[model samples]
Target: MDWVVKFARSSIGAKAVVALTGAGLVGFVVAHLLGNLQLFAGPEQFNNYAHGLKSLGPLLWAARLGLLGMFVLHIGMAIRLQSMNKAARPVSYQSKKAQASTLASRSMLLGGVTLLLFVLFHLAHYTLGVVDPQFLEYKTAEGWHDAYKMTVIGFQSAPVAGLYIAAMAGLAMHLGHGVSSMFQTLGLNHPRYRPLIRGIGPALAALIFLGFVSIPIAVQLGIISLQGGA
Candidate 1:
């Protein structure tokens, strides 16, 4: 419809779309972290969890596709909104001061780009079996994919683990600002609750960062390994 197209082209609508898609992505991130935490349960439990998800077959692919769509829309709208903002102010300011902007907010674009590259590398390393094909060949006694073994062995490389840690830190910074911005865009930032709402973003970002990076850190510390210690 014309109205739909017009709304989508408007800055407000673009922001709304970004906010909603970002919320969806955040939900996925939390769910993914929870699933990843199964590694602490040892090989059998982690393998079973991976197998269960793979057993979904078509459903799994559908979920992936849905997530991919949301990711694309979120990034696309964000870039478009940035362009619109720049176009509205073609002339550069004589001097700029970040009185109200935080470092995370100022570096959102760079952080987004970094995260995008990390996501692609992650997919190649774990999902596609491109980084290390031998990992995919690993199988448990039950014949299920040895995801636990793969994970432990994959992070054995200090470089790989360091990259993951750094990426997670970047993710935390992005989410710290992005989450609060999403709430404000959605009009949930009431004066009475603004402080609490703003705090939620950084708190959640820290939790997610810890949750994700814990896997690699535990691997490096030998707390989680193929030796059945974890």
Candidate 2:
């Protein structure tokens, strides 16, 4: 137990923890995107999917709790590592160079913070329905939560759609650097596979970004909407 605590406090261990937790988060993101993509299948299919998850009862809550734990650990470790790095270099550099760093890597902290804010807002808007309580009251013919209608109506607002698009862009930027960094920290970025590993991050990020943003964009363009308005 003592050794566990000490290792967790160590830099190498911290990075490993971040990498592991980040992988978990990435899995959740991809899974979530896939489920959300069912929206294109129409209301019946989408509502059934949402209801099926909710029908899990305790299992669903347990999964949510596990995800929350991962989020807390990942954010806490990142902040600790940042503090450690700053403490090690107390003096500002006379001049800084980013010749080898990509913009995604350079802005990781900012992008992460942006995504955090967006996540909170997203939960409030959709998960809790606080942002639009009326949407939660929507029910399908089968009495299941009308998530499809809620989503379409919610994204109909220009402000909501714009915010969603911007947040997804930030998410893409964060994932772009975080994925490759995770691979490196996990000792999977061998020279032979470095290019492929590095490319995976950006490619996955771009796909996720497009997938998520397409929903709101489609709604805004009237491509995805209620049969004849909410």
Candidate 3:
């Protein structure tokens, strides 16, 4: 167990864990964005999509729990690494220049923590019954929450939609740094394709952010309504 902890704390090993987890999360975001995209198709389509997920019953919950666990572990490691880095900054270096890290990279750790806070609020508003819920009783035939209707209701609020946009913005900031770093951590930073890594990372992050944020923006713009449509 001691050696396990030590290995996890090592720079290379820590980066390996971060890279693997970050890559997995990118895949998840893609799927989620695709699913959410149905809102543009209309309510019936979006509802049907949500309903389909609920139909999976225990299987859906199991998948959610597994993903939640992985998310927690990934976040914990990130927080740990960030803390270590902050602590290592010399105390007596009073005249130190403050321009070492690019703003995006320097603040990703902070944005991640803020994003975590947003997630909790989001789950409560849209999923859990803890907060002012979007749909009180979207119960499925198998007693699962009617996730489709709930999603529609939650995004109906102009304010909520705006906040979601902000949260996705934060997600983009984190991913902008994360994607390229992940490839580097995984030893994929070949000199021949370094440009590819740099270019693709921001592009992918932009797509993910834009896809997720668009639904809310469209709703707020009145270009679409979530009420009776998907």
Top-scoring candidate (lDDT): 1
Best by TM-score: 1
Tens digits of lDDT, candidate 2, 1-51: 999999999998899999999999999999999998888878888899999
Ranking by TM-score: 1, 2, 3
RMSD of each: 1.6, 2.3, 3.2
Summarize candidate 1's per-residue lDDT along 8-55 as a digit string, tens digits.
Answer: 899999999999999999999999999999998898888999999999
Local error of candidate 2 at residue 40 (angstroms):
0.5
Off by over 4 Å in 1: 94-105
lDDT (10s digit) by residue, model 3, range 78-153: 7677676667875534443644353555678776876888989887887676766437677655565556556666
True-vs-predicted CA distance for residue 104, candidate 3, Å: 3.9
Better candidate number, 1 or 2, judged by TM-score = 1
Model 2 sits at a Cα RMSD from the real structure of: 2.3
Clashing pairs in 1: none
Give lDDT for model 3: 0.76
In terms of lDDT, the poorest run of 10 residues in model 3 is: 91-100
